[model samples]
Target: MKNNRFLSILFICLLLAVGVSAQNTVKTSVPDTIIIPVVPDSDTIGIARVRNELAAAKLNEANMRMEIELLKYQADAADSLKQAKQMQRIDSLRALTPGVPVVVTGDTLFYLYAKRGGYTPQQRAQMDADAIEELGKRFNLNPDSVYIESTDIVTDIMYGNKVIVSFTDQDGLWANCSRDQLAAKERQVIVQKLKELKEEHSAWQLGKRILYFILVLAGQYLLFWLTSWLYRKLKVRIQKLKDTKLKPISIQNYQLLDTQKQVNLLIFLANIGRYVVMLLQLLITVPLLFSIFPQTKDLAYTIFSYIWNPVKSIFWGIVEYIPNLFTIIIIYYAVKYLVKGLRYLATEIDSGHLKITGFYPDWALPTFHIFRFLLYAFMIAMIYPYLPGADSDIFKGISVFVGLIVSLGSSTVIGNIMAGLVITYMRPFKLGDRIKLNDTTGNVIEKTALVTRIKTPKNELVTIPNSFIMSSHTVNYSSSARTYGLIIHTEVSIGYDVPWRKVHQLLIDSALATEGVSADPEPFVLETSLQDWYPVYQINAYIKEADKLTQIHSDLLQNIQDKFAEADVEIMSPHYMAMRDGNESTIPKEDIKPQTTGTGSTKPA
Candidate 1:
């Protein structure tokens, strides 16, 4: 503006200087160039010279006007250059001037360089930002409400009653633009930002979001319904499969999991899948719903991050666990195959196909089981580190607690297992072997790590703890019956009147006549005890079958009675001796004497 004023004053000075130069030129000019006309003799020559002089004067006047215009053009050029330099200087000052950015939705629209006396540029920028934010928050507001007002010093870019920002001449100077131009530009920017904010949160946009949300919910419900329906269908199919495809999972003769347990496991897995899918749908839908509204847009992202963080962590945990999982799988399979091979070897040995010296076939399976248990324990120890959350205190704590419980509660059980192992290698008895343990004599039927079951001769089942068996004596009669023959012996009392040789011969003959008696190893009789009135005659006979000991003994006693009755050799009893020698009543007629008394009922006599 000062440059403009200077240019105007220079134009006025040029006009005055031109007027003075013209007057001076008029004063300095020769009076009609009389000296030039003197050389002209003729009137025609004088008239031609005068016309030439007038042409010269017009030419000189045109040249003087050209000089004046040239001088003015130079002054204008100087002023333009000076103004450009001042503009450059202002631009440099503006570059050095600190400004606060007016940010909207994380984007900086412009800088606020103007500051009041009480407020810094930052504070001014905050006011502007707050105004724009308040305006944008109105979903029903229109961008056309934004307008500008020009005052003597400042231009205000306003929306309704809110001033978004204002521009002054100083501000324009800083921006290197006019006040109105800067204000208009700022207004345009603010209005455009407000329009974007309004559009984003408008009813139409919200409706679209609602539609999307509905679609998502519909899809989610559909998935849930599908999952449930599929689960029901699978349940029905599984129920049907219970009678068809599903069976108890068994290893050899041992059932690991029942058919019903398998069905329940499958159903549980299906339910878990359903919950996971529904939860995933909810995660997606809730975030999308939140994001539809501009006010909750950041909240939407926050919620998404919250929900996705765990999912992402779990996914990454699984991904990272893959290598460990593979390692565990490999270790499991290696141990499994090794155990399988050992089991095969044990089976071979147990079936008597394979034999080792001093190692009985009965020892094979139990030893294999011990080795398998150790291998499984070692496998657990090896694989524990690779398990997810293995490093967690809770996992370690649980493991320690379980181990502590087992160690504390399983003393007797462990003793039994150890005794069972010892009993197995000791080859004390096997299945179907007639054995006597403590006061229980029976055939061994089932043997376990903790207890052994025996079926008695009277069909009574007796379970004996292996630990107790370890401390007690066990007689395995059948152990040598197949080779040597089990001796079945019974004692009979004979009167002293009978000769020892006769008593011995009679008992031996009775044992020989009995069924199930082995004659090759002849029966023998021994005088076990000699009483005052009778002698104990013990007869021993060998039988190939030890399990039939009860039946053989019954038959031997019956045969002894018959042989003694026929031979007239009395098989004496104390009662018979008392009746015969003490002169007891021989008839019922002598012992029964009926005596009737008054008011007494006569009982059978």
Candidate 2:
């Protein structure tokens, strides 16, 4: 009870001191001089003025005494009931004053400041907030040592005499309440909040956090298991589908894809499903786990933003590109139909049904392909700008890189294409035509923009680049074989002793005996050279079938040998040097037998 009385006395003294300080703050600009009339009785006038001054001083003293006495009486009677009444008065004052919020430790406390106070509501609120924050920090460091104290001049919320916050007359006026009263209330709230914070750091709270972390981990594990189960089920379903329903898809009688390809596609789809499920699980799990902890909660939001922002951007980008996509589709189908029309024309021309005066039939397909390529390229060029991100630096850089690569590597390809074009227009040879280029003699089997393939007489397949073929000379045997038979020639050497007329007759007979040789154009023999050892006879035969030239040549040589042998003629074409007895002849002994004729003349067999 004595302690309560002392506290009350201290609080009242603090209030009285605040009032005195507020009174001292008042400024006076008026002069202290007073003029008095001195016409008659100057002493009486001076005395009357002195008495008036005394009376005024006494009245002012009496008013001050009355105020002090009222304060003492209120302080003495400041029990629970009187304090409640005072609080009511404070509440009424607050209703009239402007309220400003003072924020401390994330909590808001209202403060009211009166108009008569020098401080504005905002200034008072700011000051109170700063002081409270400082007090909170100090309370956090040493909560037990912090207390509120009232002195004769001021009330302070202090930590060992170091004032955390002070309340004076100006503060009371600004708050529109008793300074000590407001300070005490603020101190109690701040201390209570600090104690709550300390309690939150206790071992029990730590245990609770640990338990929550364990539960979260268990939940994440369960989610992982569920995700895995779902993926496995999906994969199994896909596998079963692949085994049963997903057979090889075919077009008409042709197999468009085989069973292996179907299985691979199913496996690919299953893998995609598995990975998608895993990714979704990871995304959900990571953010959830991060949100479970205060330290990583912000990071969780950041991570979500990192993925979501790009996904959102891509979704919007695709939505915005819908018109461009439609344009691209229109252009693509337009080019496709145009190419189809060109292909139909090419086919007709290639089949000789469509004739153009200047356009060769062989050029139709290749020209169509070339034109189609150019059209597609033009379509792509037209659509390039409308593509999403086409103007971005990365897209431009990739395009430039691709262009550079093509330009650097296409030199040989360009040459081949050009040579193929030239070869096509030149009409050197067509497919299945027997032709000879340099030393290679063959029938053309295939021709493309890059290379020409030939099947040689030896059944060897030879592929020659179009550029190489363009640079070499070519001889086409089948070109004129149909209209004018191609000539097949073979050379034979014979001893001068054998008559040239007889040799020519023998060569012509051999050529005529060859099956592929044309009978209409009679075979002829030319005495190409008169050498020292023998004469060179070239037998020229017309053959309607150029492809059978090799077989016919072989047959002709056999026929020549058989004819020469039958006539008992020795074929010593290359040079014959032999030591012969006087009776020995070049003919076979059996053929050298003598026979008697009708006139009794002897003849060699």
Candidate 3:
């Protein structure tokens, strides 16, 4: 672009200089009429007067011709100045904005500024250049036949009935000229450019171009090979350096990356650089090859544009998006710090360092997570407009698509999450609580957003979904065990011979002897039912450790049997009692020996 501007300035200066020199050189050719002596009455003086008048008239005639030629020179110089000024103005406009130059084989004939119909200036310019190039490929293209046809609205520059370009008033306005002049000037340029292209594309010129094409391809291949070879050598050298020179990357004694990773990173960077070299080679080589052939000359520029246009668009897009990018960053940080503060508050609440009215401390962390998610979501909504291409159809479409997929596929997941949230706030059973749900009794070990895990007394693990847990009933033995002890109860039937009071006393004694049973809330026995053969006695004990309820009950039962046996109470089940009136006690009397008395009968003394 700078080179084009310099050439324009040089051209205008040269034209102005020529005009000034021509104006200085201008001189009126007719000299003052020569003065002569008056003729005498004699024939010699009369003839001298007559010859002098004729010579003076002839000089006057010659001067008239010189004046006419000088006037024509002045008119030509004025036209030249006008042309130079107009070109200078057009060049100025071209430099101010983007304009496509009509280039043919490295020479820029002119730039196209105005777009007609659907074609942009760049596309129009390329089409025209391509037409001209294609015209040169013809065997019998006549430059003399190239002419300009001016109409009321447009002027067409044609080459043998083919319209090279249709110039409109807009183009003339851009050039600071009438449509007719623009067309005429451009027609000459096109003809001359086409002639040059024809000569360059001649057989001998084509042979040289082909040679140059081959050389470029060979050079590109060699560069690619050399790049690969050099990269392999660097890869090996990096590996060697890992053992010999490279140490682990660390920050203040903490290893961030090991030596092997550093070597790998070096090799990765080298590989990327190699790829970039290959890409650069292609970018240069492909365009060169295309420009080498006149037929593909436009293609060279088209390919260049293919790469350049996107790069320019991306660069400008980033530049234009800087303010919005800043806005997004600001929003992100604002929300981030807000959430950080919230997390700290939640931590204080969970640790019981802080408290809120009617808010349970256990609900703190999950509530923070919920609020954090909502805050981040709101931040995204606020920043959406500031995101580059966020308003584009593709971005919106993709968002909608992902939303649809989530809605369709994650119904169960969403349900479980909601249930988990409810369970958290409801304070159902927390970790390490002994709970029973749907006949599965176990101690809660883990709780998550999706499921709650428990380990049964038998050490069997059970995973119940939050949704399922929400719908079913739950019994939490450990929830109230510490505040109000859990009542551990069992039933046993004894014969009617044992008085209800005595039976109750024995049961209470056994329960109070149990390890996990609390004696402060003294053990109690309930006579649940009295049947014809036996009475059912229920022994209940208060226990702080609900988790040891099973083991405590087992020990209580064993203690009950031992206490009844020590008293010789003969605690008999209804199934074992045959004769209620006269039967030896089921408990054997210690220190009583059995002796034989006549027949094979044993008796206790």
Candidate 4:
């Protein structure tokens, strides 16, 4: 009766709640206003009135807009009229100036000079003939006498003002006198000794060429001898000095000799000397040889122009490209050095010999990797413009193709690199850590861009991609192994007949007997399950040595078997039907006694 009353009260309360919720929802809603206020015949009266007012407003707005547009057009027309008037005034002013030219229309000085000094070919010829006639008239010295003589006229101006005109008769006055004097001298000398140089022109050429060749050969030999002598003497002195310095150290303390270092220093000095000599020779000999040997000057100029011009062009091109290239390279090196330094510092800190207190431990490694990726990407961008033919379509195509290829093929590489960086910053494990990722269990030997190398317990190297390591489940046995120690657990099955307490005792004893097992942690035995055939037991103990894990596990299992044998505990396994039966029975026979005389008795019957 009390339960029924309670149920009835709950049902009544639920009903009252639902009813009150519905009533409140209805009261909060807006009320309808169908009969509040009415403007009768809205379509005929109200809409018509609104339409009439809208039309009037639109007409007024249209008139105002048209007036505004007309005013704007009038303003623009006035501006154009003013511009035209101003242009006319400017033209009138320019027309008034003849010599005082307008600045915008004035000719340059070079043009004026060309106009004043230049003449057409016909005008020049006429001037020459007139000047020649005037020169003949002046030379004849009779003002009324008409004279004509062929002559050449030269014109020049001095000091920007004075003009000098000269005319010389084209007759052999000076040329005749000079030739006559040369002929007289030659005739006087021809009687004693005369050779026909024209007849022996080829032989003379050959002789001259041979003399030049001999001189060149002598000069080359002398230069070679001098250079060779200098080289020999300097090399001998350098060798003596080197021997003097190195011999004592080598004989007394060979370990401290550092001969390779000395050799490197010597090589550097030698290279400096060699470059200096080559530069000096090139500076002096090239110009001197071209200047002295005019015969070969054109060839030398052609060769040098062909070689040095391109070299200089290429050098200037390199100079222009270097700033951007160097910037990218500097950024790359900076990132590389930063990452390397961070790793070094991290290693030092982790080894317990160094500590950077108050530092944000998480920021260093991630920042380094970000800087690395950004710098390398920036370098690629900056270097693109400097590459030869980079502006061409072929280069663009190749660049795009390479970008696509890198994007497609480098997914794993990029993922691994990022994973390595992530691992460094997140610190799931460190070097020398015994970890299990997926199925590979090993100690972390090295971490690189693409993969992490681990040394397994079997002394084999296992290289796992960083992507795999990063994405998979990682069991870091050594992350907290030093503190909690690593739990070495093994599963065993025992027959159900053995008591659970006795099985637990045997497991604990076996784990305790195993080598490298920790005692303070104590051995533990877990009764994992009761199966149809056997009970499953897990023996667990803390073990420290990762390298000897397999040996320790083997020893542990052997110890468990021995311990269970001593405890007389039967380890359970699958049943065998043959072993289960007590006696042997043949197929198609059912408990028949041995009867050898059956056939003989039937025959007698």
Best by TM-score: 3
| Residue 35 displacement (Å), model 4 | 99
In Å, residue 29's CA in model 1 sits off its true spot by 45
Model 3 lowest lDDT segment of ten: 26-35
Model 3 off-target regions past 4 Å?
Answer: 1-195, 202-204, 238-276, 578-605
Indicate the TM-score of model 2. 0.62
Give the alpha carbon lDDT tens digit for every residue of 295-366 in model 1: 788899999999889999999999999999999999999999999999999999989998888887878878
Q: Which candidate, 3 or 4, would have the higher TM-score against the true structure?
A: 3
CA lDDT, every prediction? Answer: 0.83, 0.78, 0.84, 0.59
Cα lDDT of model 2 by residue, 1-605, tens digit? 47767876797787678666644442121113333546688787888689667655765686588588867777566655565565667677765765666676457765544332477667766776776555544324666666888887677878675665566754665555677887877777667765665555556766777788788778878877887787678767766776678777789999988766876676787778767877887787777777655446678889888889999999998999899999999988998999999999999999999999999898888889899989999999988998888999999999999999999999999999999989988999999999999999999999999999999999999999999998999999998788789988888988877898998899898889889998888999898998878878999999988898899889999888766765667677657754456755565565344767899998866
> Candidate 3, residues 23-90: lDDT per residue as tens digits?
44432322234344556568877776786677667656765665676567667666666766767776
- Model 4: pairs clashing at backbone N, Cα or C within 3 Å: none
lDDT, candidate 4, 1-605, per-residue tens? 35645765576566557656744554453133112235676666766566556655765675566557656755766665665565565456444633211111111111000112355423433443343233322222322222122222322211123221211211112222222343233233221111221222335554765676666557655765666567567656666666466533355545554645665566567657766765555554554455334346566677667667888999998888877677667766876776677677765555555657654454454555566567667766766676667899998998799989999998878889888777776778777888888888989998776789988887889998888877799888875557787888989887767788988888898888888998978989888888777778899898877656778889998888777765555566434233445563222132222344656542210
lDDT preference between candidates 3 and 4, better one: 3
List ranges where model 1 is wrong by over 4 Å: 1-135, 139-192, 201-287, 298-311, 480-483, 578-605
Indicate the TM-score of model 3: 0.66
Model 4 compared with the native: what TM-score? 0.46
